[model samples]
Target: MWQQKTIHLAEKPRGFHLITEEVLAQLPEIKNIKIGLVHLLLQHTSAGLTLNENADPTVREDFLQYINRLAPEDLNYLKHTYEGDDDMPAHLKSSLLGVELMLPITQGQLNLGVWQGIYLGEYRNFGGVRQLIVTIQS
Candidate 1:
């Protein structure tokens, strides 16, 4: 079986936010799948998607700090500043982190690890609502 949907995620500020529950809430059909895979693609260049520690908020904070260091906005050589100072840096961070995720679904639920969770890498301060193309194969 195959299923697909475009989910509109809520707007968020710049940070790593846990979105496991939010995604699940939108896809109740996952409960019908006995065993499958779900692929999520973020339809944006300025933001990204990743899976990481869900139990600790500090991990998300650390991720923000690390990525900020890796793609600092203070560089004066950026050519894509038409959007803003964070535009080029946001793209860099999105590329580094990626914009898609594929995870296992078992027994009608996402088979994530005990400490794992879906993260939306909101690189822009006012990225507005994000879009995710969710595909499920059972």
Candidate 2:
């Protein structure tokens, strides 16, 4: 069986947010899959997706810190400054992270580790509603 759906996440500030529950809330059909894979693709260039530590909020802050250092907003080398100073850096962060994630589905639920969860790498200051194309194969 194969199914696909698009989920629009609420707008968020520039940071990493744990959104595993939010995604699952929109995908009630996941319970029908006894064994399968869930593929998620973020339809945005200024944002990203990742799976990481969800128990501690500091992990997210650390991610933001390291990534900002990796792609500082004040770099004079950036040319894509039409949007704002944060736009180019946001793009860099998006590329540095990623836009897609694939996870195993077992017994009608996501087979994530005890400390693992989905993360929304909101790179833009006002990224608006993020879109995620979810595809499931059972």
Candidate 3:
């Protein structure tokens, strides 16, 4: 079996946000798959996807803080500044973090760890609504 869908996520501030529930809520078809794979692709260059801690909000905050330090907007060498200070940095962060994820499905549910969850790395300050293409194969 195979299924695919595009889900639109509302605009969010620059931070790492837990979106596992949001993604699953939009894809109830996973309930029918006993064993499969779920592939998620975030369709944007200035944003990214990852898997990380889901229980603590501080983990998300720390991720934002650390990534900002790694790709600061104040770098004078960046030439892509037309979009805003956060734009180029957002692109860098997106590349470093990546834009896709593939997770296993077991017994009709995602086989994520107890502390693991899908994260949307909203690197831009005003990235607007993000689109995620979800593909499931069983």
Candidate 4:
């Protein structure tokens, strides 16, 4: 059986530029770690995932600003009135941004590109807990 851990995403009205290595470290030990696949999924609809440049904080900031400009909080949006203007934009951001990712694991670790990292893109105003399902297979 594979191992699992639930990551509690911090309240990020401003979005999260986080590293996922900590979560991966929690997987069960396996031998002959020749080939494995890691699957990640965000439990919230308003949140998403992106595999992007990890070396430069500027890259993360640039990407985040770009997305917000692409999908700004619309006061004119109706659905937002209920959850606030950020509501619809959150869904749009999540949609335009996306969710779920499959990573290739090699040598008992993830084979990510140089300067690449996994981030939980939270588009909501109030963030409390987000669930991440991690599966390690041999």
Q: What order do candidates take by lDDT, descending?
A: 1, 2, 3, 4
lDDT values of the candidates?
A: 0.96, 0.95, 0.93, 0.73
Give the Cα-based TM-score of candidate 2 against the true structure.
0.99
lDDT of 3 by residue, 11-130 (tens): 888799999988888989989889999999999999999999999999999999999999999999999988999989999999999999999999989999999999999998899999
The model with the greatest lDDT is 1
lDDT of 4 by residue, 1-138 (tens): 455555555455557566566555555453346687777777877888889888877887787788889888855645554676777777888888778888887887778888789887877777556777766666
- Tens digits of per-residue lDDT, candidate 1, 1-138, equal 888999999999999999999999999999989999999999999999999999999999999999999999999988998889999999999999999999999999999989999999999978999999999999
Clashing pairs for model 4 are none
How do all models score by TM-score?
0.99, 0.99, 0.98, 0.84
Which residue pairs come into collision in candidate 3?
A: none
Error of 4 at 98 (Å): 1.2
Candidate 1: residue pairs that collide: none
RMSD of each candidate relative to the true structure: 0.5, 0.5, 0.7, 2.4
Which lDDT tens digits does candidate 2 get at residues 43-130?
A: 9999999999989999999999999999999989999989999999999999999999999999999999999999999988899999
